[model samples]
Target: MVTRKLAAVAAALLTGTLSLTACSTGSSGGGSSDPGDSQLNKVLKAGELRVAVLPDFPPWAVQKADGSFEGYEIDIAHELADSLGVKLKLVSTDGDSRLPMLQSNRVDVNVSAWTSTNERAQTAGFTIPYDAHGAGVLFKKGADITSYQDLAGKSVSVARGSTNDTILTNDFPSAKPVRFDAISDVISAVKTGKVDAALESSYTVAQAAKSDPELEAISNPPLDPQLVSMGVLPGDQVWINYLNNFIRNLIASGEDNKLHEKWLGEPLASIVSVQGNAA
Candidate 1:
């Protein structure tokens, strides 16, 4: 059922462009605030922190069958709310909805597995990256693919409007990208032999490989590292600064590494080092 829906969404995205609607309702947990109030002050006064998180991204954030969210980003959200002396309100989001939720004021911060890019920086303020990953291809174990160049003239799948989509569209023109609405769809397409391979985050590819012995992640001549960070609306230096400091504290106190180990089964990468400088 999900696959069929994703197929329709992908077709729409391919023919048209992705569209996001701002949420009409305010956050459910936070106290009401005047429209004119600053976001930082509003959250502080309301005693609730609304955080947007991806419900589908594993090891980062995932919604369980019981409707509860868990993973590294969920834990980080809890800590952020605690630091601010506010209750945490988790707002479920996806690749397309995460930024819109933040921009529409439906959430205070986006802790989704958001990678900081120059284009996104124009519209959103980002805390220093908490994690880093690179784009890679996930293919069947016996596939002949060994490098990025090997994908030329082949069909590859990617999540539409995602960093991987942009990478393939801009950097690898020879390969055809079968754009999907969700990463799960990309994985499904590859597993089912609907596409030759799938281009996505190395972490996601690794997780997929663990579940399916036939799948493997290839990073020979790795793509540019994507810096995963928390996002807020642009021009909020105060909030951005606070979030950055919070992230720094997480790293310095070793809590970040702990979460990484618990969820990813590995220590935090050195590339995700603490960035204490103000934004």
Candidate 2:
């Protein structure tokens, strides 16, 4: 349990400045048209939902000093399980192993900062996105650098298989990109000047920047803005539809934004246009 004083410190420490991006995407899969089935029954029958989380990804999922999990996504997962009337079991995973954990059924859901993208969606379905996650570069404070083009000849760190990698690969193309096994590795590389700066998630990187006064997040945070989703076993129409509706209802009732504020410490207030396509 959290002592009130500590909780206040955490809440105060968590803050962000979100800039909305224009969302546009491919054609929506449309409705299940015929309303295929419900996956809620299977989940309820199991009596528990196993969720995989990246323990080091702060503001999303992280292991507390007490050796248990706590973070925005971790708390949200618990609430989701509660709503479903099932026990939510969390498994700590490294980011690289998240997909494998889901593939092997080691966990029923992957809620650890899993960004929804076109390629990933080919293998897995993401919930109708609740937020647009922007990326950023963490650099030594007062070093004076911003914008993707500034990375021209400098070595920039990025995580393997991350949207940041994809963006830098396509966007920079000229920078000597250093790929790491995890975000923590990339952050370390930047702090030690192993690389000029590291491409990382703005949300978590902001927390890192605050924690380490030596490092500060660069301006012009990358904004490809992928949709975040809960990953489940593929080909289960019942489960897909059920989760889709669950998200729809959550958005309808305003809990979706609440979850964002609760975990991220910023209301996800955006000039989001009502669009049919998945962003």
Candidate 3:
């Protein structure tokens, strides 16, 4: 009996030792795997590129009556997926939802025309800028405002929670900022003369002006220019680099200019020009 008990105790000790060794091996294997391999490899393995986009932002992205998305960013998203030899899976998102979708891993990347700000850079990685624009005011063609300073003591419209709103509140505190939920609403307010002007991105303002004969977009002094980039989850250097290369290729091949002309009605601005290219 004593011999049998001793043998049982020895077997238990050996089993525990093997279990510990297996755990250690598994951990070491995981640690040794290249960090950069995971995100890009997972995307390739899935055979579909998931991208988040805003559907209501015209010229950048627009949702059609048929429920399909179209526009410059949509085309760009499709092209990126094509380059990966993967199907494009667009996850419809809004301005507020884009970053959350990326952080939660619901999408591999966000092509929502995000302005790369210092505060945003802290949370996510941004590829080299694909577009550059500044803030401007859109108003009726004969409106009194001629410069940013003219906004003083005037009622201006801005999308709530946007950089434009922040700019108005922080810089032009004297201006009465009428906040709206959508950029469309801000534009509408200005169009109907409910507001004297609407502060918005230069591209958006320009598009609005082109579409409406009574409206005009002006950026005389040019508010802070924003560099728009694709957003990926933080720490994905591999994915960021790939996107940067893809953007460079798009510029070199003239696809970027094509899209810009198709949507914005002009060749893409020199602001988007790559290092070696003449804008």
Among the numbered candidates, top lDDT falls to: 1
lDDT of 1 by residue, 238-276 (tens): 455556667877776677788888888888778775452
In model 1, how large is the Cα lDDT of residue 115? 91
Ranking by lDDT: 1, 3, 2
The model with the greatest TM-score is: 1
> Model 1: runs farther than 4 Å from truth?
1-36, 219-221, 276-279
Clashing pairs in 1: none
Better of 2 and 3 by TM-score: 3
Per-residue lDDT over 79-114 for candidate 2, one digit per residue giving the tens place of the 0 to 100 score? 667666678798987657766776666776777777
Worst 10 residues of 2 by lDDT: 15-24
Clashing pairs in 2: 39-238, 39-239
| Stretches of model 2 off by over 4 angstroms after superposition | 1-42, 269-279
Q: 19-136 in candidate 3: lDDT tens per residue?
A: 2211111121121113234355566677778999876678888788999999889998888877776688888876677677866778988898788889877766778888876788
TM-score of 3: 0.80
TM-score, structure 2 vs. true? 0.78
Query: Model 3, residue 77: displacement in angstroms?
Result: 0.8
Alpha-carbon local distance difference test for all models: 0.75, 0.66, 0.74
* Root-mean-square deviation per candidate: 12.1, 10.3, 14.3
Model 3 ranges off by over 4 Å? 1-37, 219-221, 276-279
